[model samples]
Target: MKQVKINRLSDETSAQLQLLTIKDMMSLLCISRPKVYELMQNEGLPFMRMGRSLRFYAASVQRWLIEHEQVRG
Candidate 1:
């Protein structure tokens, strides 16, 4: 008998593994379309260029947001 290992992902991990489109980013960040492009260019928002289309990973975007968050004293 052979034993195989199974890899499992938590619910939160699975949710964070999604690829977000421009419209998805706009809705998620509540920003305009142009703003999304500006962030990708100037703000160093993590993304991948697939042909002519841009794709953002949910986890990377969340991480970027957290890194850029400003705290008011």
Candidate 2:
């Protein structure tokens, strides 16, 4: 997994920030809502449930992306 340093945010959110909403994940991956959901079900996308919403960790998502690309190749 590659290290993801969010240098844009200087506030406290820059550290120990793991959870990301579906919308945020969509933007980072540059994909649509349906595509993200499809990956979640088909691929082993590490995630968590915050009440009724779904969340993903930045590091884990980065790792998953790496694994996904490897699989594609």
Candidate with maximal lDDT = 1
lDDT of 1 by residue, 14-63 (tens): 98888999999999999999999999999999999889998999999989
Q: List, residue by residue over 1-73, the lDDT tens digit for candidate 2.
A: 9998765875556544668999998899899999889899999888889899999978788878887785434
Worst 10 residues of 2 by lDDT: 9-18
lDDT for 6 (candidate 1): 92
Worst 10 residues of 1 by lDDT: 9-18
For residue 10, give model 2's deviation from the true position in Å: 12
My TM-score estimates for the predictions, one after another, are 0.78, 0.70
Which RMSD does model 1 reach against the true structure? 2.9
Model 1 clashing residue pairs (backbone): none
